[model samples]
Target: MDGTVVTDRTAETVGADGTAGRDALNAAAAASAAEGSRSEALRTLSRVFGYDTFRGEQQAVIDHVVDGGDAVVLMPTGGGKSLCYQIPALVRPGTGVVVSPLIALMQDQVDALRALGVRAGFINSTQDFEERRLVEAEFVAGELDILYLAPERLRMQGTLDLLSRGTVSVFAIDEAHCVAQWGHDFRPDYLALAVLGERWPDVPRIALTATATPATHREITERLGLPEARHFEASFDRPNIQYRIVGKDDPKKQLLRFLREEHEGDAGIVYCLSRNSVEKTAEFLERNGVPAVPYHAGLDGGTRARHQSRFLREEGLVVVATIAFGMGIDKPDVRFVAHLDLPKSVEGYYQETGRAGRDGLPSTAWMAYGLQDVVQQRKLIQSGEGDEAFRRRAASHLDAMLALCETVQCRRAQLLAYFGQEASGQKCGNCDTCLTAPETWDGTVAAQKVLSTVVRLQRERGQKFGTGQIVDILLGRKTAKVIQFDHDQLSVFGIGDDLSEAEWRGVVRQLLAQGLASVEGEYGTLVLTDASATVLGREREVLMRKEPKRPAGRPKSERTAKGERKQAVDLPEEALPVFEALRAWRADQSREQGVPAYVIFHDATLREIALSLPADLTQLAQLPGLGEKKLANYGEAVLKVLADHGRLEAGTALEDDSSSSGAESPSGD
Candidate 1:
């Protein structure tokens, strides 16, 4: 019974009173065993990881898995998805085998677990032969509580045979959404994971992901052969993140300004669409005094790993990257996630933005969306390598994203609805639309004018044009392209003189979003859809969100002056120095230990420590996130810091102006 689940066959035996007495006895024994196991799990959680109670659906999910039940858990980032399996693995017998997608982050994951005094190890291609041998020996000897392996490793016979020699308590499939064939981040190797259940029917399995739509959820269940597994769907809403999308205007400059004004010196990620864009944006931010690094598949693996390591270990560093950057990132203090380009789909957008505010503090999800983004995305989908059905699915995803961008309603509401969840209210008061509602006006004439220009280019000129040329022809601009094509002679020319270039682009973009227009070919030439006829015939009235006269500024409620972003956190003035001192101490510990700072102590834990000003180890143990092991390891050091800070406060004012700087933002690691 060494943590291994053993089924009781006593119910199969019949007594003199038939099977009733035996069945009742079996039921009582099973119930008592389950209760005992749950109590052990709770103790393990507190003693190893700190945390008096489980969060959200953690206890239920863990209990079911501990009792030998398969489960599919869909929880948001920083929602403690790891504990759902971690606790059970500790409560049950043998080692927890975690199937991870990010081989590079395995070291950090295992390091974090080890810091909690849990015996954790990982075997991946990155490990040398000696390292793999040591971990394998540990697992076989039952010295390791958890063992992590890449999903691809499961296909190797050697790896499979190695697992057979050790008792596996549970199989945890992390980043489980990768099983979806058409998901935003699909890995071909994940499809092979269905073998775990086939091979070991007695061991419980749990598939966990931070992002997945209803369709992706079904795909995961079907592909992973977990139809009978209990599904635990938590709310996808991350209320701590404020969502904002502004029309692109000199996008690089716009991004620089946004960083300077809102997230100066904050730890964040800026996502671009191309490798070139990632490099250029990183350079621009560095030039403008925003410390940023570039990350994409184009970069060397070592460089990418170095940058990721720096972003994880350092504070107030931004990593400008393509979609390849964040998948299983466990950093808890990232303040914002900015998008320099529009994501191709809502799922991708949601997943990327979800990387921010993982610690549940206030953060932002900003994007510099533009008409060109819409056009470029459409062009990519049309020219992408996929079947008609794939293209249709891609188009549908894009439409949902575009709808979210253009919606006058609550952005969070629309996003939640896309994932098949309803919002609690119409206005969340945390998004750009709710903060400063945009005006939606009738654009029937504008839509008709733009559509007529497309018609004139096709019918009269017998040529197609992109948005720039179409916009020029409507504005009656005598540019070289227009004069070369003699586009000014058309009847539609000069009819749109009332609108500026930006306004015209907005009209075209909205039309495309509403399906009144379509983009075709590699050039992104405008084309009319069947829906255009009604608008041109005055039979349909188009409602469009009016573009603000300028890019919308930060909401007044959340706005702060340059280098004052830390004011958003409602900490007392006296506790600021203590928090900064703890951060400094933690930073030193991280650098000395060669692990991420958050692994030593998350910002949330430090903030609580500062607020409570724990006088001794006993008081410190009462706080959240401080398990028995962490207290024994660092509890005295924390108490010493508090004592020293108290003495300094008693003697002097402790007026450290640098403590309030932007680099010390509330969410800094």
Candidate 2:
């Protein structure tokens, strides 16, 4: 929001220069509400909700559905895809039936909508008979604008019968990619959604998903029977979320440092590869003065529920979890999403990292990627219970993900290209690649040394060893295993003594990524691939990114100094107090209403209100996010806050109030 000037050059794409290319979200949302000559939609967005403009293709998609046409929306996670269908549902004739995948997601959306004074409700397994019956009665009575149903419930004949009895305006299928078997978050129940095209031939259908490759995209269209729906695929770029992939050194300490240096007293999610890692990371964080809770399928149902509730309802509490957590997480204020291990695929990485900065604020997606991740992922692909085709597909996905980690080009461009979208420009000032350009060295000699050693060990000695063993032999480490194999007698032994162990590791990892070598058999032995010949013969120059030095096993020196870190919010000092006061009020209101804090207001909205420093309802109502319901509901209280803070200025910048309790160490709820 505070970036330099960038005028709108393309309407469908969100440019890398931040919000400059787009109108204010609320303003766009409000203007979008005026779809028809006399748009109730525009009023709903500004008054009931708030906002004045639409983002990317949101207005087009909304208008398509409102005009009684099917649609497919492929926008990024934080790109406001929900508004595409939500606005249309309000403006169109009857209630919209939304088939959602998860109960948590459904509830979160329902709560946020109700907070806006929109007649939204959901019926899921989480609700009892009475709760479901009340929502059903509302639908039958035409008292609801949107009804969210789990895909499983929507698949049932009883639910279909109920829908048939009511006046349904549109059928909205969310998380549409889940229909594809190749998708990482596949849901079998989603396949039944295809019947919607047959059963509700006249009802306009809108299918939406945040993550989908060309392959996954086709599967979704074919499986959902929406091949003819007007497609609105917005650029899948989150420039506000900075991407950084660091080599694994001490993961816990590295994660701790990230928290202290860049994300102090902010909400975030930490992902680990295993249940054990989740538990250990949570415990480690708590012990080291960062509040955290563990969430995994292995945890008891009640415990998991409580932890998730705490993570959502409480501010600045980190949730350390395995892949078992975080899909369709509606938390909008997460400042960072850290990965202690490499995700299995690029789709998974994109979806997980997209979870941060959903509120359109600056956030970080930090990962400690390394060689162990590569080995484990390969083992997973090879050991799958499915047939060879499935294994091959899984391996292909893993290779694509690895290439992304190893790419020398702009990370955002490569990532966008992976999704069949061309980035407007290169060098997005966000990712580690663009921010701190890593110097590349000609790795021809290093590649030759590793490839020759592997060949000699296999052809001359009839031995195939893992990467570590090969490195040990080359570094002249005559350990018991090396002595047993008599690998020390080889000509290539000690040839790689010129590079540090970490540097050699870089060469080895890059070789595996580039397909110059491959892991073979159950022993995980490394062998040269056909591609190795070019690098070994000097026909092609191997290039590698210089891996940064890993700090020695000491925590203190590893912590980046406080002054070097960037401040997340850039606002005037005068607005700082008002921002904290608003946050305090929001917390109180959320607790009173028994809803998540974000449901009442997003941090970005609060930041805007704080910086504007509007002294009364008229001025406050004009603020970007103060929708009709929000203004009528909280305008007086907000005015009281500004009045209490003395005379307000119009152009005050936003500053963080460091004195707030948010900066304190955790005393768990």
**Top of the candidates by lDDT:** 1
**TM-scores of all candidate predictions against the true structure:** 0.95, 0.88
Which candidate ranks first by TM-score, i.e. highest? Answer: 1
Which tens-of-lDDT digit does each residue in 1-669 have in candidate 1?
422232344444556876765675667678879889888988998888888788899999999999999999999887889999999999999999999998989999999999998999999999899999999999999999999999999999999999999999999999999999989899999999999999999999999998899889999999999989999999999999999999888988988888888888789999999999999999999998999999999999999999999999999999999999998898998999999899989989989999998888888999988899889989998898989999999999999999999999999999999989999999999999999999998999999889998999899878999999988988889999899988989999889989899999999999999999999987889999988899988998899999889777677787878867765455677778899899999999999999999998988899899999998888999998898778988899999999998998876643555465545787765
Clash tally for model 2:
20
TM-score of 1: 0.95
| Predictions in order: lDDT | 0.90, 0.83
Report the number of backbone clashes for model 1.
2
Provide the lowest-lDDT 10-residue window in model 2.
1-10
